[model samples]
Target: MKLLNDDLRNQLKEVFQDMKDDVTIAVFTKSGTCNTCTETISFMEEIETLSDKIHLKKLDIENDAELAKAYDVQMVPSIVLLNKDEAYVGIKFNGIPAGHEINSFIPGILEVSGSGEQLPEGFLKQLETVKKPVNIKVFVTLSCPHCPGAVQKAHKLALENEFINAEMIEAQTFDEISNKFNVSSVPKIVINDQYEFVGNQPLEVFVEEIQKTQA
Candidate 1:
């Protein structure tokens, strides 16, 4: 069975029309051990059929170890989006972006395609203060309605600052990591594996939490 229905596919085509540049989606998956790897690839295949600007690259965690390492990918069914120049700008998804997670996934592609909304200048200035390396792991379940907003905010910060990297991790799919972070909520935001918060917070809240890491 196909993941995207006719209505969804048509809606996606309309959305892809707004893509300003090329986006290369590099997917990393490992065989045998990963339960969702096959389904993830099939979903991506359907996505690739939606637009000419969207390119899909299939890779394995084992076969593409060096490349995966360069992107800091440590899990299966991971997706790394590269910009028009094929540069990795630190946007990633660590599980199948299905269900409500599609909201973030689609916007991520548009952002990488150079058609993203611009952040306020004040907020852009605030982002400059982040000098130290920061990793944001947004733990979410596919069915969570509000989880995508949190994921989008995290990825937007990653796009604005080089020192920051963000990823949307499906909670149930990667329960071991979720347990490590003590995630019992729908949208759990963990920063640097040290600081954490829950819910679809405002941009100011995200900035404030990140500032704590610098201090």
Candidate 2:
């Protein structure tokens, strides 16, 4: 098993610590690659050791093909972070979430999952204009926790405005939207005909963009 160095371990520690509630670290692995797969499994075990709150579940791609398909995990050696009820925190690791990258993934999970619970006050000013129905398309993946928050925010606005049509385009399912919009990131939001907003923006900003679509 590969052990994380002191620096990386500390960083991953900070990430799990920020979790307001329990989190599940889903490790999706394939059996073929001797170097990458072996190292990834060992790395996840080390992460599992770091905390009891951060539970780890390993699944075989070959055996659990449908499981991987459901989450749209097209590649091996991916780490997905989930909240208490298995809500996504949008933490998807491609190669491995080790070293500097480890720090990035965990923090994102907390922030994305946390962002939707409460938005900032000033950010509300951003959502002042919603005059017409705009096809606010949000492209997401199951592994992304932040995507739900973004989707929730969109739904919130959808409830408020008659002219607003908010829809989520699962990137794995809606490959066209992903390719058309160049969706290389998680929780990417696009408004009307041209404007693009990535990440979970505050509700105010979302409202502001809705108004912009009228222009």
Best by lDDT: 1
lDDT of 2 by residue, 1-215 (tens): 55678886787677667566666767778776634667777877787777666677788777888766655565666555566777543334444544334334454445434433444554444444555556676667767766766766765454344455555555664465489899999778888758888998887677777777777
Query: Which segments of model 2 are wrong by more than 4 Å?
Result: 1-3, 7-15, 112-215
Evaluated against the true structure, the overall lDDT of model 1 is: 0.95
In candidate 1, where is summed lDDT lowest over 10 consecutive residues?
A: 114-123
Clashing pairs for predicted structure model 1, backbone only: none
Encode model 1's per-residue lDDT on 1-215: one tens digit a residue. 59998999999999999999999999999999899999999999999999999999999999999999999999999999999888889899999999999999999999989899988898899999999999999999999999999999999999999999999999999999999889899799999998899999999999999999998
- Per TM-score, the best of the predicted structures is 1
The lDDT values for all models are 0.95, 0.63
TM-scores for the candidates: 0.98, 0.52
